[model samples]
Target: MLKDKVVVITGASSGIGLLTARLLSEEGAVPILAARSRQKLAEASSGIAGKHEIKVLDVTREDQVKQMINEIIADHGQIDILLNNAGYGQFESIVDMPSEEFGRMMDVNYMGIVRCTKAVLPHMLGRGSGRIVNVASMAGKIGTAKSTAYTATKHAVLGFSNALRQELRGTGVTVSTVNPGPIDTPFFELADPAGGYTSNVKWLMMKPEYVARKIVRFMDSGKEELNLPLKAAAAMRFYQLCPRLADRLTYRMMNKK
Candidate 1:
């Protein structure tokens, strides 16, 4: 379904973004790989077999985002899909977390999605068809200790996507979110510098390729929301229905990080 379509992916240099780009290329989609580092973006797209483009983009910057979107439109005629995947996290208690660190996370994880969506929306609306896939986290649904700031940012992402999806009801523009459990990615190099969370949840980690395939499937299907690793989704649902019980039972697990 994505064949010959233009798909712009933020954070396309590595992890899920890079893996998804490869998958889209194989499906005959024109993947526009966008990331902060031009070198990294170029290197990431080097091995892809099908047609793709590399554009340096930092979703946190409004001007850069607008210009990049305009350039893509000028080059590709229209962008069929936008994958908002540019984000990072720092896990720490609210008291121990620097205020600036929290703000930075909000800017990238939440505001970055806002900026890119805003920049691309007008074009998508004009064309009357487009797909926006945001990569959130399972943390967005269930808050845990040490991830207060990160969780808040993701919650904001989910909130933004929920509202936007409703607003675009008949506009032929769709908003979908991917809320995945901890995936084996370089995201932890910074989110869990002490290696505590990584080690604690090593067994639960999902591979990036697995998550990437799910993302591609969502793009084709236009599913409203996708929660990875069925077990995690069930746990999130249980936590929602019984917060007190969840807290009592999962306190030890939550504190492992």
Candidate 2:
């Protein structure tokens, strides 16, 4: 269904972004890979099949983000899909995390999506049809220990996506969010250096390819929200229905891993 579609994916250097690019390419999508590292982007694009492009972009920088969008349009004529997947997770206690680190997290994870979305929205609106997929996290829906900064940014992404989805009701532009649980990617190494969290939930962690395939499916289905590993989604829903019990249950689940 995505064949020959002009899709742009940020954070295309590794993890979910890189895998998603590969899956989309197999479906015949022309993906433009974007990341802060040109070398990394080149390496990731090298293994991808078919004709794809690359852009060295730091979404936090408004100028670079805007330039990338303009260039993509100039080169491809239109952007059919945008996967705002450029982000990182910083797991640290609120008191231990420096204010600058918190600010940086918000800038790259939250504001970065805002800037990229803004840059592409006008063109999508003009075309009267487009797909936007924001890769948020399950943490966006529920907070966890040592994830203050990361959780806050994801929450912002969720809020932004929700508002944007409602606003674009009649514009023919659709917005979707992917709330993935722990994925066994390099992301965990940085997000949890101690490996405690990952080891505990090792069995539950979804594979990057698994998450990527689901996301690719959503792009065509126009699914508003996707929560990987149905069990996790059910737990989150239970939390929504009963905060007290859910909180206690989450604590137990985390430690049980």
Lowest summed lDDT across 10 adjacent residues in model 2 is found at 248-257
The residue-level lDDT of candidate 2 at 158 comes to 96
Residue pairs with backbone overlap in model 1 = none
lDDT of 1 by residue, 143-179 (tens): 8898989999999999999999999999999999999
TM-score of each: 0.98, 0.97
The lDDT values for all models are 0.92, 0.90
RMSD of each: 0.9, 1.3
Which predicted model would earn the best TM-score? 1
Model 2 lDDT per residue over 1-257, tens place = 89999999999999989988898888999989999998888899889988788999999899999999999999889999999999998688888999999999999999999999999999999999999999999989888888889989999999999999999999999999999989998887788888888878878889888899998888989889999887888887887799888888667565431
Residue 196, candidate 2: how far off, in angstroms? Answer: 1.8
- The TM-score measured for candidate 1 stands at 0.98
Cα error, candidate 1, residue 51 (Å): 0.5
